[model samples]
Target: MARELRGHDLQCAIAQAAAVIGDWWSLLIVREVTRGHHRFEELLAELGISRKVLAERLRHLTDHQVLERRPYQTGPERHEYVLTGTGRALAPVLISMQDWADRWLLADGSLTGTAEPDSAEAARVHALRGTPVPAPLLLPATLPPGDGRAPGAASRPLDVVADARATVLFAYPATGVPAPLPPSWGSLPGAVGCTLENRLFRDAEPSLTAEGVAVHGVSTQRPDEQETFAAGEGLTFPLLSDMDAQFAAALRLPTFRAGQTLRLKRLILVVDASRVIRDVIYPVLDIPAAVEEAGRMAMKVVEGP
Candidate 1:
C-alpha cells in the first residue's frame, strides 16, 4: 500500500517548506535531478529507491508545483520531471544540509571539503591521517613507467623533460571503471568531490598545455585502469600508473593503505625541465581553484624565475 504524505497545518514559512519537501525521498529525488539524473531509470538506479516510493514522491512533488512533468519523447509518450523555479530555490537548502552534516556528523579532517563518510571512506581518512611522508621537501626520484603505454606517452617511462617546459603531475589515490559501490561508499567523505576535482583538471588541460605546462594524471591504479579512464573521460594528458609503489618509495611520498595497497594522498607537483620540483599543492581542497592556481604557478615556472 502507498502511504500518503502527511498534511501539515501550520502558517510558518518553515512549515510550508517542510510541507513541500519534508520527506527524505523527495529531497533525494531533487538532488539527483539537479545532478542531471533526469530520467526515471537514472534516478532509480542511482538512488536505489523502490519504484512505488519514487512514483509516489514524483506525484507529490508535481502536485505541489515543486517539479513539472514535461514530455521528452513523442511516440510512446515518455516524460521527465524537472524542477520549477520554486524548486530551484531549494538548492541552498540541500547545500546547507551538507554543510551542517559535515560539521557535526564527520570526524576532524574527515570531510576534506566534501561530504561525510561511511565505513570505507572513514577507514581511508583514518589511514591518511596516520601515515606521514618522512621527507616533505625534496624532488621525487624518477621512475620507469609500469608499461610502455601511458596516457600521452610518445614512448615508455615518459621523459618528463621532453614532455614540456614544465609538467603538472597531479597525483591522486586511484581511478576505476564505475561499478557497484561498496555498501558504505555513498557516505564516504570527499569521494564524489574527488571525481569532480579530476574532471576539473581534465577539462583545463588544453589551456595548460598551450601555456607550455603539460599535465599528467598520476595514480596507483594499474596501467590498464588509467588507460580506460583517460580514454573514456576524453582526457588528453598522460596518466602515470605507479602500481608497484616504486615511485612512491623513490620520493618517500605520503601514502595511506587502503586494503593491502598504499594509495597516494592527493598532491600536485610542478616539475620543471631540470626534473626539479618547482611547486607543490598538497591536500587539494578546492577543485576549480586548484587547477587555476596550478596554472598560475606553472606559467611562472615556464617563464623562468
Candidate 2:
C-alpha cells in the first residue's frame, strides 16, 4: 500500500508536493484567483481575510511564481496579479476541493443561495474532468420598444452581467434623483449575480443566457476611479460596456436618488429569440422578484425559444 506523506519525510512525492502547497490559505488564494478575483480589495472582500494575512499570502504566491503581476493602467498605476501556468494546474485541485466540501460542508456551510444538488448529482460534477465546461448560454432577448405614446408601461430589461463572471457581472436599479442602493443591497447583487450565474453554469454548460448584459458595461475602467476597486476591478465576463443607459431607457425603469446623481434604473430582462425581450423585471429591493423571474426565464431558455 502507498503510505501517506508524514513529518520529517522528504523523499515521498506527496511530501514534495506538500512542501509547495501544504498551507490551506494558499489553496484558497488559488481558488479565488481562478474564479477571476484579481485585485487586493476584491480578495479581502470575498474571503474576509485580514489585511496582514492577505498580504502575506499574496507575497508567498507571487514569490513562488504561482501568479504574475501585470500593469493594467498607468494613471494611478495599480497592479493586478494573474495566474501563472503553475497556478493554472490547480484547477483540478480546486474542483476536487469544492466537490469534497459539497458533501462535507453542506450542513455547516450552505452559504446563502441555491442548495447544492444531492451527492449523486454532485458526483457527476466531478466526472466531467474529462469534458470541457461550456460557457453560459446567453440569448439575445431584448424588450420590445414601448410605443412613444405610452404613459407608464415598464420599459425593458436592465443591465445584466455575470458577477464573478460579469459586479465582479463583467456585475442594478431605481427612479427619480437617483440613489445607489444601500451598502447591504449593493453588496448582495454582486454575490447573487455570481451565484445565479454559477448555478446556471453548474446546471448545464456554457451558454449563459441572461435577461441582458448591462453590468458588463459599468465595469469598464471604474467610472469612479479610486485607490481601490473593491468590486470594480476586472470582471469575469464581458458587460454590454458604456451603453448601460440604453437598457435603462428602453426599460423605463424608475429613477433612483443617490444624493443628486441620476442613476440608471435597475431592470431585469427576459428575452426571446431574435433578441426580442419577452419579460421585464423592474428594480427589485430583494432577491425574490429577480429569483422567481430568473428561475422561470432559465427554464424557458434551457428548454429553448
Candidate 3:
C-alpha cells in the first residue's frame, strides 16, 4: 500500500506531488507515456513491469487524475493511457531530473552540453536516427511581427518543415542576444558557439531554402529573446523556444544548467517531411562543418535513392 501525506506534509506542494507520483513505477509510467507509449502492451514492453503491477499503477494514476484512459479500440473495449493536463505539466520536472542525473550521476558533474564522441551520451543521441519525432509536440516560435500571423504562435517540427523536402533542426544552448548571458557563460564548455552557429545557418538559409530545405534553431530561451535576436541578426529562419522543456523531455535530449535554467546541448537533426529523424549530429565539434553537414544531409534526404 502507498503511504499518504497528511497534516503539515499535505500542505507542502512537493510533498503532495511526491505522495502522488513518488512510486518508482508511477514516475516511469509517466515518462514512457510522454515518450509516446500509450497502449498497455507498449508500456509493459518498455517498462518490463509485471502486468498486475502495471494495471495497479495505471489505475492509481487515473484515480489521481494524472492519467486518463481513452478508448482506442471498439468492440473489444480497449483503452490507452495518456497524460492529463496535470501530468503534462510535469514535463519540466522530468527534464530537470534528467539534467540532474546526467550531470551528477552519469558524468563528472560538468556543466557542458557537448559530449565526447565515444561517450555514452553521444551514443544515446546517435541512436535517435531511426526514431519518429512526435507529431503533436509543438514549441513556441519567435516570429516577426506583422508577418500575417498572430503575435505568439506555436509550431510543430513537421508543420514548420511541411512545405520543404527536409529540415535541419539545430539545438543550441543559448544565444547572447536581447539579454546578456551569464558572466561565466564564456568559460563554460560547449557554451561558446551558439551565436556563431546561428550566423552560419543564417548565411546558409538562402541556399538551403532553394534546395527545399528548411532550417530552424531551438533553445530554452524565451520567445521574445529569440525574436529580438532573430531580427537583429537578419535571420530568415524561425527560432523555436523550448521554454517549458517539453521538446527536451519528449526526446530525452541532454541538457545542462546555466543561468538558473536548463539549456539544450548543441546538436543537429536532419528530419524528412514524414517527421522521421534521418540523421543526428551531436557534440558539434566544428560549427562551420556541422552547418555544411546539415546542408549535405538535407540534400541527401531530398535526393533519396
Candidate 4:
C-alpha cells in the first residue's frame, strides 16, 4: 500500500522523520540498499515494490541526498545505479531493524505458544553448567532439561581446526580434536563458505574469481558441500550444508555472544595452493577488512618461493 504523508509543520521532529522515511516501502528500500544491494532492477526484484512507487521513492531519496547513483554498464544496454555514501551509511539502521525483527518477529514460528523467554537466569544456568535444556527451553517440545550431549550419543562431529600455518582442516571430529591456535585467526587464509542460500547467492560467488578474489566468499549450499565454481556470476564453490549445521559446530563457531542457538558464526578462511594455513578471520562485521586481509595473504602465498 502507498504510504500517506502525515504532517502539518516542518519544524516537528516526528513529521521530519516521517518525511525522510515516511513509509513502509521507503524504509524497506533503505534496507535493500544496506544489504549490499545496489542496482535499481536488483533492488526492485528484492523488494518486490512496484515501479511507480520505487521510482518515486528513489527520486525522493536522491533529492534529499540520502542516495547517490553511479553507472555500472553501458552500450546498446547501459546499466548503472548504486548506493552512494549516504546510502551506505544506512547500515546501522537496517541492522537494528533486522535485530528487532529477530526478537519480535519470528523467523519460523508455529501455534506452539507466544511468550518471551521465561527466565534469563534459567537460560544462563543451563549453559554455564554444560547442561542442555530440553527443546522446550526455546522450542515448546518434549520437556526434561538435561545435558543435550550424552555419553554414547550417536551424532557425527564435524571437526575443524585452524593450525599455526593459517590453514584449516575440515574433518570428522570422531577421529581427534585439533589443538588451539595463537588466540587469533589473523593468520588463516581468506575464504568464506556460505551454507545453502536462497537470497545472497550472487553475493557469495565473488570470493573465487580474480576480480572476485578480494570480495570473495564461497557458498556451501549443497548437502555434501560439493565444490563448484563459475568464472563470474554464479557461486564458484560448494556450500556448507544447512541440514544439521555439523560443519558449523566442528569449527566451534559461535553465532552470538549470548550463547544462543546453534548458529555457526560467519567465517572467512584463506588457503594456499598446497592448502597450508595463512590466516583465518571470524566474526567479521566489516567485509572489506576480512576480504582485504585474506587477499593480502593470498598474494603473499603466491609470491613466496
Candidate 5:
C-alpha cells in the first residue's frame, strides 16, 4: 500500500508523484503494462507476483487513473489493463530509471550511451527479439514536401511496415544538418557515426526496396532538424523525430543525455509485417556492417522459415 503523506510532504510534487507510484510492485506493474503485458495472466507470469498482490497493485493503479480496464471478451467477461494518458506520461520516468540503472548498476558509471557487445545493456536489447510492439504507437515523421500532409506528420510503425515484408528501423544519436551537433558529440563513444549511418542507409535504400524491405532512421532531434537533414542528405526514407522520447520510452531503448536532451544509442530493429520485432542489433560497433546486417536480417525475415 502507498504511504499517506502529511502537509509538508503534500506540498512537494515529487512526494505526491512518489505516493502514487512509490511501491516496488506498483512501479513493476507500470513497467509490465508499458511492455504490452496487459492481461492478468501475462502480468502474473511476467512479474511472478502472487494473485492477491497483483490484484491489489492493479486496483491501486487503476484507482489512481494510471490504468484503465477495457473489456476484451464476454461471457466470462475478460478484460485487459491499458495505460491511461496519465500513465503514458510516466514513460520518461521509466526511461530515466532504466538509463540510470544501465549506467550505474549494469556498467561502469560512464556518461557514454554506447555499450560493449557483451555488456548487460546489449543483452537486454537482444532479449527484445520476440517482443511485440504496441500497435498504436506513432512518432512524428519528417516527411518531404508535397507528401499531401503538413510538416511533422505522425506515422505509425504498423503503417510504415505494412506494405513491406520487413522494415529495418535504425536509431542514432543525432545528425549535423540544420543545426550543429553538441560540442562533445565527437568525443562520445558511439556518437560519431550518425551521418555515416544515414548515408549508408540512403545508398542501400534502393536495394532494400527491391528486396521488399523498408528503412527508417530515428533520432531525438526535432522534426525541423530532421527535415533539413533528410533533404540535405537526399535520403530515400523517412526520418522520424522522437523529440518527446515516446518511442525510446516505449521500447526502453538505451539513451544518454547530450546537449541537455536524451539521445538514442545506435541500434537497429528488424520488424516483421505483423509488427513483431524479429531481430535486434545493438552496440553497433561498425556502422557499415550494422547496416549490412540489418539488410541481411530483414531479408531473412522476408524469406521466412
Candidate 6:
C-alpha cells in the first residue's frame, strides 16, 4: 500500500500541483488572465475581487512563476499581469475543469456569456465536443455598408468605417421601441433586455466619447423603425440596421433563433479606426455595467498595442 503524503508537501505530483493552485481564487485568476483581463483594474472589476486578496494571490502566483508582471504605464507606475509559459500550460487543466462543469455543473448553459471567450475558450469548446479547435477568427479589413439610419433617416447602407474613429457597435435583437414588441419577444432567448441594453449603451455614450470611442447601436430592425426609436429616445448616436443580415454574414456574428426571426445575440464589438476588432463583450447580462467594460477595453487599445 502506498503511504499518503501530508501538508501540501507530498511527494506526489498532484499534491504539489494542488499546493500551488488549489485555492479557488488562484485558478480563477489564472482563468481571467487567460481571458485577457491583464490590467489590475480590469481584473478587479471583472472578478469582483478585493484588492488585498487579489494582491496576495497575485504575489503568490508571481513568486511561483505562474504570472509575470509587465509595466504598461510609467508615470503613475501601472502594471499588467500576464501569464507566464508555465501558467499557460495549465490551460488544459482549466479546460478540463470547465468541460466537467459544463457537463455537470452548468448543464443548462447558465454561463453562456459571462465573459468574452478568447481563443483558449474556443479550444475548450471544441475539446468538449471531441473535435479539433478551429483557428482564431480574423476580423475583416473593413465592414460592409449595411442598411441603417443616421439619426432620423431611412434605411440605407451606412458607411461603417469612413469616419476613422474607434467605434463601439452594440448589437442586439429587435428592440421594444418605436413599436410594441411582438407578443413573445421577452420570452425569446436573447431578447429579454434588448431595449434596456441599448438604453444603457446610450447612457454611457458620454463616457465612451470622453475616451474617444464612438458608440453605435446595432440590431436587425429596419432603418425606418430604428430611426423612430432613436428620435423618440433622443439618442445622439446612430443605430445601424442589418435587416438583410448582410453584416451578420460578413462577420458570422452569433445569433439565436427567435421563432421565425433570428435575433442577434447581445454583442459589443470594439472596432478601431483600422477596421480591426480590438475587443469583444458578449453575454451581456448586466447591460449598464457592460458599457463601462467596453470603455475600459477601448481605452486599453488606445493606450497601446
lDDT of each: 0.61, 0.42, 0.86, 0.39, 0.86, 0.63
Cα-based lDDT at residue 279, candidate 4:
50
2 versus 3: better lDDT goes to: 3
Q: Write model 6 residue lDDT over 1-305, tens digit each, in one string.
A: 11345865576798778767878789888877765568888889968989998998899889889999999998999888987878867755664465446434535444232223543433332232211111121212112134342433334455443243577777787767766776766555556776677677768777777767787777767677777776666676667775554444334455544445545667777777666676766666677787788878778766666
Question: What is candidate 5's lDDT per residue for 90-161, written digit by digit as tens?
Answer: 988888898889989988898896999898889888988988777766777776456686645654232334
- The deviation in Å at residue 304 for candidate 4 is 22
Residue 21 in candidate 4 has what lDDT? 71
lDDT of 4: 0.39
Ranking by TM-score: 5, 3, 6, 1, 2, 4
Q: Candidate 2, residues 11-101: lDDT per residue as tens digits? A: 7766765656667777777766765567888888978899899888888788778888888889999887777878766654554444345
Tens-digit lDDT track for model 4 on 132-160?
11111010111111436342333222212
lDDT of 1 by residue, 1-305 (tens): 22343455455667667767888899888876654466888889979989999998999999988889999998999998877877766655664564344345543534332322343333333343222222221222222235444545442354323357887877776654532333444454433354666788878878877888888777667665665566677666666766654345434344544434445667667777666667766556666787889888889989986
How well does candidate 1 score on lDDT at residue 202? 75
Q: What is the lDDT of residue 25 in candidate 2?
A: 72
Residues 1-305 of candidate 3: C-alpha lDDT, one tens digit per residue: 25877799978988888888989999999998988889999999999999999999999999999999999899999999988999989999999998888778878887786888987788888988988777677777776445676544554332333457898999999998888889999888888989899999999989989989999789999888887888788888888988887788888898888899899999999999888899999989988999999999999999996
Candidate 2 — worst ten consecutive residues by lDDT sum?
Answer: 219-228
Which candidate number maximizes TM-score? 5
**Candidate 6 wrong stretches, greater than 4 Å:** 1-155
Return the TM-score for candidate 6, rounded to 2 decimals.
0.50
C-alpha TM-scores of all predictions: 0.48, 0.38, 0.93, 0.36, 0.94, 0.50
Stretches of candidate 3 exceeding 4 Å from the true structure? 144-146, 150-163
lDDT of the structure predicted as candidate 2: 0.42
